[model samples]
Target: MAARVGLNGQAPRCDHIDLLPAVEPGLPECKECLALGQAWTLLLVCLTCGWVACSDDSPGGHAREHYRETDHPVVAALAPETAWRWCYVHGRIV
Candidate 1:
């Protein structure tokens, strides 16, 4: 999907981007799902602390849960070739 752009034709900036960890904490899979013996459809990396969790489409909405509990505002897809980020507060891709 095309990113949402601002009046300047640039992708809209998310304030939470500042919260992204200096070192990306992305994982190949959701450790939470692995520990629970559950299958996950997609993986997301919390930009704030590098918490890896399953996407909302999975059995456990762990990524959303992490945001709910910690108020971490951003996440990025952990899958290969996917370069996009989501801002929970804006409810949109950033």
Candidate 2:
């Protein structure tokens, strides 16, 4: 599958992306959703503060929530397709 491109047809530099911590291979769960007894289809970890949240496809959309709350722009997929990273601020994949 193709990684998502920005609507503007430009991919931002990965170096510009804010990464607080490398993805955790050990913990594959979304902490926030688990606390409420919810399951997640996908997991995204905030690249700024290493916060874990469920993807929009999942029930809570906590990944976007983390972005809204902290403006932490980049998030790496916590599990599947680990090569891709998303920028919530510019709305692109890097």
Identify the candidate with maximal TM-score: 1
lDDT of each: 0.84, 0.76
> Model 1 — which ten-residue stretch has the worst lDDT?
2-11
TM-score per model over all chains: 0.78, 0.71
The digit string of per-residue lDDT tens for model 2 on 1-94 reads 5655545666634454634555444366788888999999988877777778889899999999989988888888886656788887667677
Summarize candidate 1's per-residue lDDT along 1-94 as a digit string, tens digits: 6555665676576657765666577667887888999999988988788889999999998999999999999988986588888898999887
Error of 1 at 20 (Å): 2.8
User: Over 4 Å off in model 1, which ranges?
Assistant: 1-12
